[model samples]
Target: MRLVTYRATVEAEARLGVLVDGTVVDVARIGARAGVPLPSRMLDFIRLGPVAVTELGHLIEEAKGRWPVDGALPLPSVILLAPIPRPEKNVFGIGLNYIDHVAESSRALDTSPELPKQPVIFSKPPTTVIAPGDPIVHRADITQQLDWEVELGAIIGTRAQRVSREEALAYVFGYTTLIDMSARDCRRAGQWIYSKGQDSYCPMGPCIVTADEIPDPQTLDLWLTVNGVEKQRNNTSHMLFKVDELIADISQGITLDPGDIIATGTPEGVGAGRDPQEFLSPGDVIEAEVVGIGKLRHPIVAG
Candidate 1:
């Protein structure tokens, strides 16, 4: 099932929902109808552990048995928000984890292409998140070298600590599309937090496709388009360090909670790697996706 966080009414707070057949079914309402308990927020729901997800699945089936669910709303009628709009912690990011991305970035930086010995990681503050159809502010006066990186976001299901690569996949709850919006000109060798964590820099979600639905996370295709022009395209299979490794590596040092978003590094084809280089400007529309998850389209607007 594709889980979503959406707002149906203008003044309503975002609510947990499940997308089915272009419709958004209110999870709370359905849970009530099926005599199950569900939280209104994705993070809270996820914290309930796998049993809760299993129960929600059962509830969904129960609701389906009734058909024409009373709480079901047309998906387009609601505003979709990040699967977990305000993650409990900074979003974990991987840098230079794609073989081709490494080469492209190395060339753009005028350096030799040598893969990092371990996973390259960074963090994006919670304020950087924006949902689908929202605007990615283009701070024109500040940085001119804006770039896009489309990545697969893995949402943790249960608390993870010192997990091994073999057992890491079990900690994932679902997957979502993430655009690791960056400011290339802001780079200063050792400084990345500011360049990658600016407000509205992380645009995630159309819906979080439950991990079970994706047989193998690394086999999914992901891509990005600027306006109508396709720019970045690659499969997760190309990632140098797969999702399980990243999770296992990160968890060894820090505890990962439910709803934590780990944006697996992006593949090649970014604007910064172009022959003459390119950057985003106001009025640009970016459509990014990870197949089987969903698509996220947002506009770039001047601040």
Candidate 2:
């Protein structure tokens, strides 16, 4: 079942709901009708594990029979937030996972840097997150070169430590699309923290598809377009290190908890790699899509 966090009106508080067809069925109201106490927040439900998801699935099935026919809850989509708006931890981003991205970045560097034997990881502050349709602040004064990276984001469901690649996927909750907005100038200084940690730099979600729905995470087609022009086009199959390996590698030292997001890097064709570097302008719209997950679109605005 597709779950969401939404609000009917701007003044109304956000509530967790289950997506049915094209409508959102509020879980609390449905749970009341089904005589079950549903958790108030998405994180709470996520912490409850598969049992909660299963129970919510059953509630949705029951609500379908009475929805619209009888007096059931029907919400408007104007104020819907992504499933998880503010994750507890900053997003874990892998750099140079795609060969073309590595090649392009290497060519631009003053000196060719050796590819890391392990995953090159960086953190994007949680404050950088913005939901689908939200405006992406361009921060023109701070960054002249604003680029977009289309990445497949994996959400961690269970607590994990030192997991094997074979069992890594079991710890995942689902998948979503992530637009890794980067400030090219800041990135060139040294570390990726400042370049990637700007507010609204990480725009993710439409919905998180449960891991079970996606049989093979490595074989999906992912791409991004800037104002209807395709800039990045590649498949997850090209990933140097697959999702399972990434999870296992990340969890080697740190303990990954529920709701932690790991963005499985982007392919090639970023604006920074262009001939004259075609960076994003204030009016540009970026659309990032993964085959089965969903699409994330946001307009660029001056910061």
Candidate 3:
């Protein structure tokens, strides 16, 4: 089931719902009536584990009876927000997973960085997250080389530590689309924290697709386009470290709790790797898509 979080009205707070047949079934309301106690927020659902998700699925099915009703629950599109807005922890990201991205970035740096003797990990602060259709803040003064990266974000379902690659995928809740907006200059300063941690830099989600929906994570096609021009186009099959390996590697020493997001890295065609370089400016539109998951589209605005 595809789950979403949205605001039904300007005055109403954002609430979790299930996306079905182009309508959102409010899970909280349905759960209350059905005598199932489920959290109204997506993060809470993640924290509740697979049992809660199963209950939510049942609630969604029951809630389907109420949709298209006149003046009852408001139409879903009236005020939609980010599905998993404000995650508890920084969005974990891996660099140079795609062979093309590795090659291009290496060439741009005039040095071939070793293909991660280990998973080169970094964090994008939670504040940087925005939802699909939200505005991406382009800090023109601080960064003249703003770039876009289309990445596959994996959402953790269960808490795990020191998991093996064979069992890594079992801990996943589902998948979503993420745009890892970057400031190239800030990144080149040596530390990636500040460069990656700008408000509205991480735009993710339309909805989270349960792991069962996607049979093969590695075979999916992922792409990104800027202002109607295809800038990044590649399949997940090119990833140097696959999803299972990434999860196992990341969880080796640190515990991966529920709702923790790990972006599996991006493919090629980033602006920073271009000839003479291309960068994002106000009014630029970015759309990132992954098969089986969904698309994330946002416009660039002055910070």
Candidate 4:
């Protein structure tokens, strides 16, 4: 199921819906008219447990029984927000999780590219999140070296702590595309938070696909383009740390809840890893695409 959080009115609360046949049908709204009980918010709906998911599945199936868009709103007629526009906590991030990226960056900086013995971790504040069509702010005052890293974002459904790698995938709610917009120079100064956590730095969503739809999370294809030219392209199969390992390691003592987005790092082909760095500037458009998930686009603009 391609689930989303959207709002048609400026004063409306975010509502959960299923995007099907080019229309995002209000699950609860339609279900209510059909006399089915469905939660209106994605987080709240997820909190209802598996029964809720089953109900959501049933709702979509029922809606499709006749026609998916029969009573649904045309997707283009509404504003699509990030699946979770505002996360419950900071967005968890893994740095240097791809071997190819590590190699390229190390060589670019003239350092040995040794594989990390542990997952390199970081977090992005909630403010950094922007929806698919939103603008990615490029603040000129402190940065001229903004870059892009297309990553696979894993959304947690089951709360977990001390989860085993074998069972880590069971805790995932779904997947989405994550573009870790970064400040190359500030990050080079060793301040990851400032470099990666600025307002509208993280662009996520299109929709949160239910976990069942993605059989193997690490087997998806990841690619991103700047102004119609592909800049980064790779398969998730090359990730040094698989999704299960990442979750197990991070959840050793930390509890992951529904709507928690964990960016599983990115692959090689970033702007900073070139002889002459290529940073994003005003009017530049970037698109992050993940197979099985969808595309997330952001237009770079001056702040």
Candidate 5:
């Protein structure tokens, strides 16, 4: 099931939806009309766990390919927000999880070429998130090296700590496409919070495909493009530390609660990794995708 958080208008409250036949079936409306209970927000819905997912699935199946189910709206008639537009906590991130990306960073950014012995973890503040079609702010005053990294974002459905790699996938609620917008030159003393955590730096979602629909997260193909030209492309198979390993490692002690997102590191082809280097400027456009999940397109706008 492809679940989303959307709004009929800019001023309307965001509501949970199920995307089917190119139309958004309002989950809460369907539940209310069907005499069932369902939450209107993505985060609250996620906290309900499998039971909520099961109920929503039944609602969709019962629709029988119906268009405009009561309260439903055409996809283009609504605004699609990030699956979790305002997360409860900072987004967890992994850096250089792709071997090829590690090599490219070494060439273009003069970073180490050797692969990390463990997952390189980082965080992006909640303010960094924006919905699909939003502008990715280019903070020229702060730094000129604005860049893009397309990543796979995993949304956690349940609390997990000290989870084994084998059981890590069980904790995932679903997946979405996340663009890791970065200010390449903002790195200071080896920290990335400022470089990658600025407002509008994390453009996520078209929708989240439920975990049951994608049993193997590592088999998806992901890529990023700028102004219609491809800059990055790689299968999740090339990930040095796969999703399960990341979940297990990151959850070793820190608790991963419902609605928390982990952005699995991007593969090579970022602007900073290009020959002679490249960067985004106002008016430029970026489209990042994790096939099977969805794609996110954001225009580069001045900060």
Candidate 6:
């Protein structure tokens, strides 16, 4: 099932929902009607663990393939927000985790082509997150080189610490499409927080496809396009640090809690890697997708 956070109207409260036949079924409402109460917030729902997800699955099945169930709204009529609209902490991002992307970055930056022995991790503050259809702010005064990266976002389901690669995946709740928007010129001291952590720098969602549906996250294909022109396209199989390794490695030191998101590094073809170099300008539209998850389409607006 594709889980999402949506609002019936701009003024309405955000509700947890599931997609069924092009409609958004309110998970909490459905559970309440069925006497199986669930949380309306995404983080709360995830904390309930697999049992809650299993129960929701049963509730969906109980719908019997019919959509627009009681309290359900057509997907188009609702405003879709990030699967986890406001994450509890900074989002962990892996840098240059794709082999080809590594080479491309080396060429663009005139650096070595050698890949990192360990994951190059970074963070983006919660303020950077925006939902699909929202504008990606282009702060022309601060950066003239606004780039784009389409990454697979892995949402943690349960607490994981010192786990092995073999057991890492069990802690993943779901996956979503994410855009790692960057301001090339904002890089300072090799730290990315300021360059990529500005307001509206991250655009995530459409919905989160529960981990059960995507048993093999590595097999999925993800891509990004700007104004209808394809910029990045590759499969998750090419990631230098797979989701399992990332989880296991990170958890070795830091405890990963439910709702913490790891944006698996992006593939090649970012704007900065281009021969002449390209950057987002106001009025540009970006559409990024992770197969089986969903597409995140947003516009670039002047800040």
Best-fitting candidate, scored by lDDT? 6
What does candidate 3's lDDT look like per residue over 157-190, in tens digits? 9998999999999999989888998888876557
Superposition error at 221 for model 5 (Å): 1.0
lDDT of 2 by residue, 35-149 (tens): 8888757777788777777787777776675763322345444465767889899899999888888888877643245655789899999999888899999886799988999
Q: Where does model 1 exceed 4 Å of error?
A: 65-70, 110-112
RMSD per candidate (Å) reads 1.4, 2.0, 2.0, 1.9, 1.2, 1.2
lDDT of each: 0.89, 0.83, 0.83, 0.86, 0.91, 0.91
The list of candidate 4 runs beyond 4 A from truth reads 65-71, 109-112
The list of candidate 2 runs beyond 4 A from truth reads 68-76, 109-115
Off by over 4 Å in 5: 65-70
User: How well is each residue in 24-114 modelled by candidate 6, as lDDT tens digits?
Assistant: 8988888887888789889999999999999998988987455435579988899999888999999999999999989999999654699
Q: Record all residue pairs in model 3 with backbone atoms less than 3 Å apart, i.e. clashing.
A: none
Model 5 over residues 90-176: C-alpha lDDT tens digits?
Answer: 999899999999999999876788999999999999999999998888878998999999999999999999999999999999999
Query: What TM-score against the true fold does each predicted structure earn?
Result: 0.97, 0.94, 0.94, 0.94, 0.97, 0.97
Cα distance off (Å), candidate 3, residue 96 = 0.6
Comparing 2 with 6 on lDDT, the higher-scoring candidate is: 6
**Candidate 1 structure lDDT:** 0.89
Q: Write the per-residue lDDT of candidate 4 for residues 81-145, one digit (tens) a residue.
A: 99988898999999898998899878775435999988888899999999889999988998988
What TM-score does model 4 achieve against the real structure? 0.94
lDDT of 4 at 141: 95
lDDT tens digits by residue: candidate 1, 209-239? 8888985898998889998899988999988
